[model samples]
Target: MQSGKFKTFYLPLAAIAAIIAGLALSFAWAAGLLGHRTTTRTFLGDSLQHFEPGYRRAHGKGICFTGVFRSSGAAASLSKARFFSQQEFPVIGRFSIGAGDPHAADTSTTTVSMALLLTADDKSQWRMKLNNAPYFPTRNAEGFLAQRSAFEPDPATGQPDPVRVAAFFKEYPEARKAVEYKATASSPSSFAGAQYNVINAFVLLAADGKRQPVRWSMRPRTTLGSLSAGDRAKASRDFLFDDIKQRLAIAPLYWDLTLQLAEAGDPIDDPSQPWPEERKQVIAGTLAVTGVHDQAAGGCRDINFDPTLVPPGIELSNDPVLAARAGIYAHSYNARLREIGLGKATEAVGHGDSH
Candidate 1:
């Protein structure tokens, strides 16, 4: 009788435990914890027809730079970050075009970018990935993925189908603003003349526990110049990189770090929208590009420049895109490091094979 009772109780309990384990495995698969996670590979596959192993999946064409950031003491009231103090911090930065292929021609794309990593004396680091665009094309990662899919090249024509592109803009009307901006905007004559904006907003925590929302831009001190038709015709495949290197050889390039303070009713989470021009602005500091080096030399080449990696006085805002970028960048960094370890690294354009 005791054996019969034990069998009845324990059998039911064993079946219940088995059902729970099965449900957990199912949930893990659905949540992407065990399979099919969206990553940098997903977006890159949608954007590019080919993959360049051992290199960044996006903005692969770049030049590394080292510099110094001299804080002006003007931004001390905004945040307690050491870089805001009146001192100099070492900086590693990269300048690149918005292309998936590292060997893409300089004139192939008008979009340019700057990624910066500033190291304070305390060893804390502030990293930023900025672009010349006034605002991002999509508000969130899903929207961006859809946008890339919509513009993906058709195998037969080697260009995006207008019907698909139109459908995408119809569904996501906000993206039209960025497309319009790109249509009317002129490409910078040189990288030194381009202004790079941190599209996402971040919070500055002061010593008094006060918080402020702000977006910043590196406003090049070099006067903006237009690219002449003759100059464009004569441009080499690496004109922009060559031009920056030649310019740096003569003197250091400089940009004033300008911050735009957000007021009431401003959108802190959406990077697709821009703040009003009349908002309060502050000159935080100056960034001086003291030297330029080949990517193969290993300066800023391996750095991910994840924007979410902020120092102690700074905090990430509720921007969904910012949060998504952290994961995507981490995956790209790790994947490329593995490739390098396996000796699968390839040479970047104009730079010899990475070692």
Candidate 2:
């Protein structure tokens, strides 16, 4: 009778322990601590191919700028953020090419980016990282990893296999849409000519507790222009940076901060899908880029420019890629900081020998 009671009790306890162990394993797998993990380090490694100790793993080529954002008070109805209160905020900005190598020729890559950190008088900050592309190429982080894997250069050919690339597009139709968009869109001749978009959606909370989903873009005041084939061939490796410096020297560059309000049917989670053109847009403010400087001159070098770093009235959306970016940026920032601390890297690096 005692033996039967022990068997019943012990069996249930064993089962319970097994269940707890299984749950732990499941959580570990989901967190990417087990199995085949796709981590931020993996992305950094893939982006650079060979690590450049002191530089960023991606967008390694860049110049800094000092600016001011003058709010129009138009977006005050949508958000209680202080920066939208018809006041001027000091801004530190960076313009970068989306190339892995710091010394990459400007003409070699069409992808460019602008990142800004705007600070209000009360010390509230709005950090934005924008891309020239209106929409992202992949819908989620997994799709991004797959896309990178597909395009990884083969050892023998020094280019990705056509079959693999074709297969990737077949599997992820959204990527093809982005490629098609780029193919048809005219290339910007100068950095000032490109419109930089914040592809991720964010929720703007007003004083009345009303929440509005929105995306924003920095629409250039400068007219869009294109470089001829001959011009591109003769362009220096730092042509884009050089052009921006020359332009700023003549006069300040300006961009209108346009906020797009999401309609009921808009997809807030999928950055690969753009909203309809009919959506309502509000000109929140104007950004004046007054000056440009090298990273060594100490303007925007230490700023991480994490998209999730917003003021109190702004909150992150459910977009997986946006969520993943925060962690990835934190990791990258911390890793680089550690490297800099250990003297394994230097903070003042990049911008075509300006260091």
Give TM-scores for every candidate, taking all chains together and pairing residue i with residue i: 0.87, 0.86
Give the per-residue lDDT digits (tens) of candidate 2, residues 13-111: 999999999999998765545543465557655643635665666787788899999999999988999989948989999999878776788887778
Candidate 1 per-residue lDDT over residues 1-355, each given as its tens digit: 9999999999899999999999999986544345335644575455444467777878888888999999999989889999899499899999999877888888778889999999998999999999999898888877888887888899999999999999998887899998888777766689999999999999999989999999999999999686776877778888899889899999999999999999989999999999999999999999999888888674787788999999999999999889878767776777777787787877552246421
Which residue pairs does candidate 2 place in steric collision? none
Cα lDDT computed for each candidate against the true fold: 0.85, 0.84
**Global lDDT of model 1:** 0.85
Number of the top-ranking candidate, with TM-score as the measure? 1
lDDT of 1 at 113: 94
Runs of candidate 2 exceeding 4 Å displacement:
1-37, 47-51, 156-159, 183-186, 346-355
Identify the leading candidate in terms of lDDT.
1
Off by over 4 Å in 1: 1-36, 39-41, 48-50, 153-159, 347-355
lDDT of 2 at 248: 94
- Residue 57 in candidate 1 has what lDDT? 77
